[model samples]
Target: MSIYSPLPPEMIWEGWEDFKPVWQEIKVNGRILQVEMQGFNQARVVRLLSTDPADYLNSAYQPGCILSFSPQQSTTPGAINDNPPV
Candidate 1:
C-alpha cells in the first residue's frame, strides 16, 4: 500500500496499532448480522450473513446501522442465550 500524502507517517499512522475493535455476531429478525460492539446492549452493524438476497435489502440490516438488543438467559443451565434485537 502506497500513501502519497504530504503528511509524515507519524501523523497518518498515529495510534494505528493501538486501536482494536470488538466484533460480535448477532441475530436479528431471523438474519445473522456481524456487528461491532458500541456499548452495553448496543452494536453497529458491520455486515449481514444471509443466503436470501431479500435479507440484504432490508435497511435495518445495512452496515453502520445501530441495533439495540437484550441478553436473555438460556434454558440450559449455565448457558448464555443468543437473543435477537427487539
Candidate 2:
C-alpha cells in the first residue's frame, strides 16, 4: 500500500520501529472493538470487529476516537476482561 502524505516518509514514520502499540479487544454496547492503548484508562479506537452495519455508523466507535476503560485481569488466555467506562 502506498501512503500519499505530503510530509516526507521520515517525518510520517518517525519512530516507527519503536512504536509498539498495545492492542486490546473491548466490548461496548454489545460490540467488540479493537483499540490501541494510549495511556492508563485511555485507548484509541482502531476498528470494530462486528458484522452489524449499524455498529459502523456509531460515532463513539469511530477510529481515532479515544475511549476510557477500566482494566481487569483476564483469567482466560487471549481473552480481554477490560470494559469501557460507563
Candidate 3:
C-alpha cells in the first residue's frame, strides 16, 4: 500500500504530501533572505550576516519560518562562537 493512499485528508499541502527545501543563494537579483539562525523571538537573527537591510524590507516573516541556505557547512554545538559559522 502506498503512504499517500492510506492517509486521511488534511495531511497534504495543497495536494502535495512531502516538501523539498527551496534552496536559494543569499543574494540573487538584489534579493536576500533574512534568516533566523537562532532564538525564538527576534528570530531571523541570522540577518546579521547580510549587509542589505532591504532584503526583508516591508517583508513579513516570523520566527520558525524555514529558510533555504547553501554551502551546507556544519558547526559544532556549544558556547557561542565555539564553532565556525554553519
**Clash counts for the predictions, in order:** 0, 0, 1
In terms of lDDT, model 3 sits at: 0.42
Over the stretch 1-86, how does candidate 2's per-residue lDDT look in tens digits? Answer: 89999899999989989987778888877899999988889989999999989889999999999998787766675554356435
Q: Which stretches of candidate 2 lie over 4 Å from their true place?
A: 3-14, 71-86
Candidate 3's error at 39, in angstroms? Answer: 17
Per-model TM-score, in order, reads: 0.72, 0.62, 0.20
Model 2: number of backbone collisions? 0
Error of 3 at 65 (Å): 1.4
lDDT (Cα, tens digit) per residue for candidate 1, span 1-86: 99999999999999999998778887787899999988888899999999999998899999999988897655675445455436
lDDT tens readout by residue for model 3, 1-86: 33565656565335474554343224324555445344332224233234556544533433345544344333545434565455
- Rank candidates, TM-score, best first: 1, 2, 3
Candidate 2, TM-score vs. the true structure? Answer: 0.62
Could you report the Cα RMSD, in angstroms, for every candidate shown?
A: 5.5, 6.8, 12.7
Candidate 3 stretches with Cα past 4 Å from truth are 1-48, 58-63, 68-86
